[model samples]
Target chain A: MKFSISRSQFIKTLNDVQRAIASKATIPILTGLKIAVSETGVTLTGSDADISIEATITQSDEKAQLLIEEPGNIVLPARFFGEIVKRLPEDQMTLTVGEGFQTTITSGTSSFNLNGLDANGYPHLPEIDAENKLTLPADILKQIISQTVIAVSNQESRPILTGVHILVKDNQLLAVATDSHRLSQRKLEINNGQGLEYDVIIPGKSLTELSKIITDDLEEVDLRITENQVLFTAGPIKFYSRLLEGNYPDTDRLIPHDATTTIEFNTQKLLASVERASLLSHASQNNVVRLVLDPEAKEGTIYSNSPELGNVQESLAFENLTGEKLDISFNPDYMKDALRSFGPTDIKVAFTSALRPFTLVPSEDEENFIQLITPVRTF
Target chain B: MKFSISRSQFIKTLNDVQRAIASKATIPILTGLKIAVSETGVTLTGSDADISIEATITQSDEKAQLLIEEPGNIVLPARFFGEIVKRLPEDQMTLTVGEGFQTTITSGTSSFNLNGLDANGYPHLPEIDAENKLTLPADILKQIISQTVIAVSNQESRPILTGVHILVKDNQLLAVATDSHRLSQRKLEINNGQGLEYDVIIPGKSLTELSKIITDDLEEVDLRITENQVLFTAGPIKFYSRLLEGNYPDTDRLIPHDATTTIEFNTQKLLASVERASLLSHASQNNVVRLVLDPEAKEGTIYSNSPELGNVQESLAFENLTGEKLDISFNPDYMKDALRSFGPTDIKVAFTSALRPFTLVPSEDEENFIQLITPVRTF
Candidate 1:
């Protein structure tokens, strides 16, 4: 393949696809990024077994300056070639492939000869029909991923739990993720809903990478779901991820509908207080902090103590406190995560008891997200 | 013990000493930070085996509004307590030790009861006489550390090579560090040297921590050396480091005096070119880059190649290339390090041959500092 393209434009496209480049060299060819030049434009593809990303640079209305001299395909080492092209000073870079799959890339006074593999050796990207596709704003997808992805389990013991379960009905989309210790559920309503309901589980890490590539500029993202693969396409970038093949657990039963006490507190203030308490508790354990609500005194106190270190107790102000007084302890990290996911300035925490899971959500609206944490038995 | 002080003041002092706190709990007591309160001031001390830092908050300081009701001492878990105090919201914090070494830390509505150890259990700071002392500008000391510390060997096989050798003779102070493959030597002359001549080896890690604590704005730092300990005192912070007890290797012989060729180049441009070349060579068995000076062409070229990956060649414009035309290959990482340590805008690189070590120094001032990197045989 022979082509010359703008350095920034190429770098941006390469970065989008580079995330899917295989970190583990199980298949040596998988570590290379496949580049193809056609009459339309240049396409870059990178993939591991689980996730694959393909980004295209087209001479479209965006006014991208690209010259296509020959139509062909080749695969070059992803990391090395990417770095070399990025460091080249020229605004436009030229790439040409010759006999024995040798590729020469030149920019200004810098030139690189890279050993390329035959593009035929690389695995083909799974093709997905656009019939069963959903469209949503990129910002909404990014928010859904950020709000719930952190709750996904990193361990592969229960492979399904490592993925975020997405459920859609009518115009509402629900994303839920849990590691048994903590759970996060986010809900969003999109206008362009296909009058169909579907459920799919996509790996949490895949969603994270997809979110990074989607900027916050309110771009439309088309999501296509096939039997075994899911495709997210935005602009000229198309991302394909292998779907988790299993039944997601019924997380509806885990969220409590009733609570003995509910209190409204300032989000930032409570978060800072919890962070301070965590510092002390983190010494003894993985940083567990306790919260005690005294309805009679109309006060909420956060306490954290390390037997070998020291203890901290802080009283937090609450807008409203009702129901029986309660004292509960849980991992501060879990609470911190829950607090961070909260959107509004004020958050309402509903507690069942000291030993049960508690829900934290925005005080004004329940449409954004809800985070639940299981309290630890500090006593 | 009872005292109330500004949270910011306490946090600042804690941060100053926290760097010396032991990360690993090999010695249980070493993980604790000792806090001693007296009528004059409050002192915080943290130490690992390699380095110890003591920072004082004097009652007389305008910024510190300390109320010392009782004088006492206690040791609290270093990392945890430091985090807790830093996160506390109140401007003023109070500390009180009740019966049975139960330390209570309170700020605003937050209070912490941390289990503290007897101050007597904490290791005492080494006592070093100030008789044999060398005073130098803190900025100079910091510059010396930054220039040579990276070359120190991390391996414990040659214990002396893990430290930076500091030699003081008359009014000249010389610092040298090497990991056998590469050596960096820097020298500075001071007026008030007191005619004292001494050689001491300070661990590179200790010096790094000291460098962080010493502000560049400070006029001078008092360096006192004892039998086994070295002390650096500037302003309210006192840093003590254990000296390595081995003779450093003679590095003077390794620096080549006569060179076959010398070239002057812009430091930043050379650094950027080397960095780009390094991206390709870093993946190879020998991370080497070759610089070929062509006097007739009035240009220089930097080349790096990895047989399994690819090869990169870039032309660099040299301000002046004299002596014999040369082509030398060396580890790109060492060259990058040497270039980064170049304090001047223009650097002169003197090469003896393709195998011998070359020296890199300021193009204008050769007396300030010099860094030497040994060439690697690419064949």
Candidate 2:
């Protein structure tokens, strides 16, 4: 392959694809990024076993400044070549295939001869037809992933919990993720119907990488689901992730249907107060912080106690407090995460009792997102 | 301590002293900060075995808003309390010492009751007289520490090498540090003549902590050297660091006087070129990058080769090239460090040969700083 491209455009494309490059060299060939040069432009592909990313640079875009001379493919070590190109002090870079599967990259006065593997040795990306594609706003997808992905379990004991379960009905799309300790659920309404109802589990790790490349400014992203793989395409980038095959737990039962007391508080104020209380509670065994509600005083108080250190109490003014006055303790970190995910100026927290899980949602009815956290047994 | 002070001021003082708080819990008291409240105001101190810091808040600057209700001293866990006050969403925090050495910290609607240890249980700071003190520009000290501290050995094999040696002559102050493999020496001309000549070795770790609290904006800092500790007092902050008791090696002989060749080039360009070359060289057993210079051409070429990763070559243009043509290889990381420390638009490099050490200094004569790195013997 022989091609000349703008340094900035090449770096930007390489960055998008490099996230999927295998960090571990167990399979040496998998550590390299495959580059293909065509008459139109150039395409770079990087993949581990779990995810694959391909970024295309087109000559049609005047800003890209890409000129293709020969059409071929080569696979070069992703990290080293990426660093070399990034540090090269030049506006344009040239790539050419040399003898013995060697790739020569030149920019300014710097040139690199990289030992490359044959493109044929790299694994091919899964092909998904457009007929199985569904469209959604990129912003909605990013929001769903960010809100729920952090709740996914890092432990592989139950591999399904490591993935975010996505369910698309006739007009609504729902995303849910939980690691048994905490859960996040978000729903969005999509106008276009794909004429199909499907449920798929996409790994949280892959969604995180996909989120990094997707711009919130973009309006739409095409998502295609195959039996074993899921593809998300935006503009000139195609992201493919291996789907987790298993039945996701019934999270519907995990969320509480009724609440004894519900209080609306400022999100920022609550987050800061919880963070301060966590400083003491984090030293304790259960990292628990207690919340006390006073209907007469119309105030909500958060307290944290550590046997060896100290105790902290913070009183927050609430917009409204109803139902029986209650005192409950739960993990401060979970509350912090739940409050952060609310992403609204005001949040309403519904609590049943000390033993039951609580739900946090935006005070405004526009955003349909909920986060639930099970209270810790402080006694 | 029973004092109500500005929250920002208290947080800033806590930040400075907390740097000395021990991360390890080997000595329980070492992990806590001792606060003394008197008619004068409040004094906060934190110490590990190697370093201690003390910051005082005077009653005169309290502006009537800050009140000292009682005089007392107590030690509280540093990490937890520091984090609590920093994250508290209040403008003013009131601290009160109650019965049983219990401390209550209240700010806005938040309050913390911390279990505190009696001041008698905390170790006393070393007493140092300021009469025979020497004052230096804080920026200069920060620069000296940053330039030479990185070369100090982290290994405990050579205890003296883990500290930077400061030698005070009649009219000069010299700082030297080495890790056996490489050495860095810096000298500054001082006008003050105390008619005293002394050599003290300060631990690299202590200097690192000191550097963090010493702002470049501060004009001068008083340095008081006692029998076992050195104290740096800048404004209201007093930093004490235990001296490393050992004889530092004589690093004067390590700097070569004569050079076979010398070249001047853009510092940033050379740094970028070396970084790109390092991408390949770092993959090999010996991370070495070779520089070949032709005096006649006024141009130099750098190359890095890895057995499994091929090679990278970059040519750099020099402003001036003199003396004999040369070829030398050295670890790119050392050169990167030297370049980072020797911050200037242009750098002049003097090389003895392929196997000898070289010196890098700013091309401008105004900035008097030099960094030397030993060449790796790459077979």
Best by lDDT: 1
Query: Once superposed on the true structure, which residue ranges of model 1 sit more than 4 Å away at CA?
Result: A61-64, A285-289, A354-356, A376-379, B25-27, B296-299
Candidate 2 per-residue lDDT, tens place, A54-83, comes to 988989977778988899999988888888
User: What 10-residue stretch in candidate 2 chain A is worst by lDDT?
Assistant: A189-198
* lDDT by residue (tens digit), candidate 2, B59-176: 7875435678888899888887888778777778788988888999999999999998888989888888757777888899899999999889999988989999988887788888
Which predicted model would earn the best DockQ? 2
Model 1: colliding residue pairs: A282-A287, A310-B114, A311-B112, A311-B113, A311-B114, A312-B111, A312-B112, A313-B110, A313-B111, A314-B110
> Model 1 residue A2 lDDT?
94
Model 2 score (lDDT): 0.86
* lDDT by candidate, in order shown: 0.87, 0.86
Task: Estimate, for each residue in A1-379, the C-alpha lDDT of model 1 and write its tens digit.
Answer: 7989899889888998899996568999999999999987999999987889888888772555899999999999898788887888778899999999999999888888998999999987897976867898887788789889889999999999999999888888899999999999988886777685779999999998888889866488998888888999887788899999989999999999999999998888888888887776766755678788988889888887767565677889788899999988899888878787775479888999999999988877865688999888866
Give the local distance difference test score of model 1. 0.87
